[model samples]
Target: MNRFDRFLAIDWSGAMGERQRGIQIAYLDIEAGTGPVLMRLPDAKNWGRVVIKNLLMKLARADRRTLVGLDFCFSVPWPEEGPLPEGEAPLDRVEELWDLVENICSGEAHYYAGPAIRSMESAFAPYILCDRYRGDEFRFDRFRETESQLSPKPASIYHCMGAKQIGPGSFAGMRMFHALRAVNDHRIAIWPFDPIEDANVVLCEMYPSLFYQMAGLKRAYDHETIQNTLAYFHSGSPPRMSIQDEADAVISVAALRALAADPTLFSDPRRVAAAQREGWIFGLAPS
Candidate 1:
């Protein structure tokens, strides 16, 4: 694994709109003692996926060794028959799935607001159906290392309903991945799939809850909660943050910083195959 000069965390949103309040970006330089700082979006409202993609490409073009953690699943559990349309050969690799989803789900916010995914489920064999699966019956990617450990358990990428669900975010994120790969003329690497050491920018899936637990903090979004979490990362001193910002952004950056400090968290010999196909969360330990 390469040592990154900068660590960035994106708290992504699945909510519909040209802009969303749930989206936020935070970063910490290896040398900045003040700790993580949230990047300001223009208009101080919400960030559109296009704006986010441009900022990332700008960073890659600058040749900065950066590791970006986006809070969404990279891929869902591989269905028994694969995600390809009928008669098409099984996807030879995970990048194929990214291309497949992007090709099918492009121009549709949150992957056409669920219907696109439903269509996908219908077209593929051994369907990972979104409307039908519930609870334990829902399939999870083998690389979802945090699901068993996190509370309420992580929902399947197919479960697209109710509060605290990750389905919509994962859908939107895969579309963003497609856009990001195309925007820079193909200069980025989704980790474990592409060679991290060779890519200009490394992108990984991240879960804020994992970091929040490691920091010994509750999942609260208040001023005091955010301040206390910042203190954990800043040698017991709180970093300044705007109350208007969401707590996940702050927690994500801190979690990313922690992952950067410890190399072992990124290296798991046993899950290499799973990581390439299903995608692993950055800091998850192998079962």
Candidate 2:
């Protein structure tokens, strides 16, 4: 397993907007001997996906191994090809899935993927159960094998409705992956999709809730709970955070630093072949 110089945890959001307040980023420097701090860009309060991408590019170019945990699914379960444009062939792999998402959401501002999703709302209507996009075939079933390994069985990539629905973030994140790959090559790698032995930056899926659970908390809504959570990782209290997202980010990165060194994380994820295309969550064991 590779040791990282820095750990970044993002509480990502895909809500439609020019800027998303729910998207929070925090990082910890392994050599700094300090706690995780919410990353504040020079002029941005809320983060736009494009800005996040640029930050990632800068990190990719840096000559240090960095572990970045993005709070979203990397790929959908390969339930056959989603509704494709006429004459387009079904995608064979995750990168191709990213390309398809990029094509569908091209020109979308703030990297919002509403258009790409709305385009397929009809074909996948049965899977979506949200009030607005509820499909006739909506059934709360279907999940990647890796996800099924977790106790709660986090939402399926196909679940596009309700609060747990991370489908929007998943789709938008794919576009970011595609964009990063187009420019950076081996500098940055999304684990389980792109090989990572020589990459300076590596990205993986994260679920902040898992870390909070480790500390016996539900959410980092208060400073005391935040302190307790960080303490579990031997980290100091986070700087005063006003929003829940900020607290989540702070705790998450601290947890990432604590969990990144496990050798199992760098090993094969599961028996399912789709796992290569549909990535695994970083800290969770595939067993």
Highest lDDT model number: 2
Kindly give the stretch of ten consecutive residues in candidate 1 with the minimal lDDT sum: 120-129
Model 2 lDDT per residue over 93-177, tens place = 7888888788778878777877655654333445555546655555566666667777667877667767778888988898888
TM-score of 1: 0.81
Cα lDDT tens digits, model 1, 44-64, are 777766677777888788666
TM-score, prediction 2: 0.89
Q: Give the alpha-carbon lDDT of every model.
A: 0.66, 0.78
Q: What's the C-alpha lDDT at position 134 in model 2? A: 56
The TM-score leader among the candidates is 2
Cα-lDDT of candidate 1: 0.66
How many backbone overlaps does candidate 2 show?
3
